[model samples]
Structures are given as structure tokens and as C-alpha cells.
Target: MYLLGLGLVLLLMKYLEVDPVATWSWWVVLAPFAAAAAWWAWADATGYTKRRAMEKMELKKKQRIDKQRESLGLKPGKRR
Candidate 1:
């Protein structure tokens, strides 16, 4: 995401002919986008993306359960 943002910024700078960026090669301006793609591919291949999604789901589930328990006058469950 950071890389993508950087790519976007560089692209904009290049397009607007911002001083230093305007002087840079197109390949240099586009490098961050390529890097972002590579990072995404690596993360997916390593299950990093799926693991993060599962962890997020588990956290939301726990929060939901805790909210319900609180509404029912039960204490929040202990954390793992």
C-alpha cells in the first residue's frame, strides 16, 4: 500500500513535470508500482494476506461476542 501510494505520487510528479522527478526516467517513476506488485505476489504466495484476513475476522468475531456478552450482563471473555 505504501509502495502504491509512493508510485502514485511519483507518477503524478512525473506527469506534472516536477523538477527532480521530471528529470527521472520513466522506469524510475514506475519502479514503486512494480515493487508493490511484487510485494503483493509474495505476500499472497506466502499466505500472509490470507493470514491477516483470518486474524481480522477472528478479532471482529471476538469483539462481537464480547459486545453481546456485555449486553447480557456477562463478563467479557479472557483474551488468548
Candidate 2:
């Protein structure tokens, strides 16, 4: 995320012909995008994305079930 934002800033700086970025090669302006691609590829290969999604889904489901239990005047219990 930081890389992408930095890349956008660099792109804007280069486009507006700012001093340091203006002299930088296209590769410099584009490196963040490449890094992001590589990062995403690595995440997919390691199942990081799916694991995060599943964890989020589990959290949401737990919250929902807890709410239901609360509405029924029951206490939520811890689950391992």
C-alpha cells in the first residue's frame, strides 16, 4: 500500500516534471507496481490472501452468532 502510494506520488511528480523524479528513469516510476505484482504473486502462492479472507469470514460469523445469542438472552461462550 505504501509502495503503491509512493509510486502514485512519483508518477505525479514525474508527470509534473519535478526535479529529482523528473530525471529518474521510467523504471523508477514503475518499480512499485512491479513490487506490488510480485508481492501479490507471493501472497497467492503462500495462501496468505485466502487465509485472511477465511479469518475475516469466521470473525463475522462469530459476531453474528454472538448477536443472535445475545438477543435470545443467552451469554456468548468462548470457543476454541
Give the TM-scores of the predictions, in the order they appear.
Answer: 0.91, 0.86
lDDT of 1 by residue, 1-80 (tens): 99999999999999999999999999999999999999999999999999999999999999999999899898899655
Best candidate (score: lDDT):
1
- Model 1: CA > 4 A from native: 78-80
Give, for candidate 1, the lowest lDDT window spanning 10 residues: 71-80
Off by over 4 Å in 2: 78-80
Per-residue lDDT of 9-54 in model 2, one digit per residue for the tens? 9999999999999999999899998898888899999999999999
lDDT (C-alpha) at residue 24 in model 1: 99
> Candidate 2: what lDDT?
0.91
Residue clash pairs of candidate 1 = none
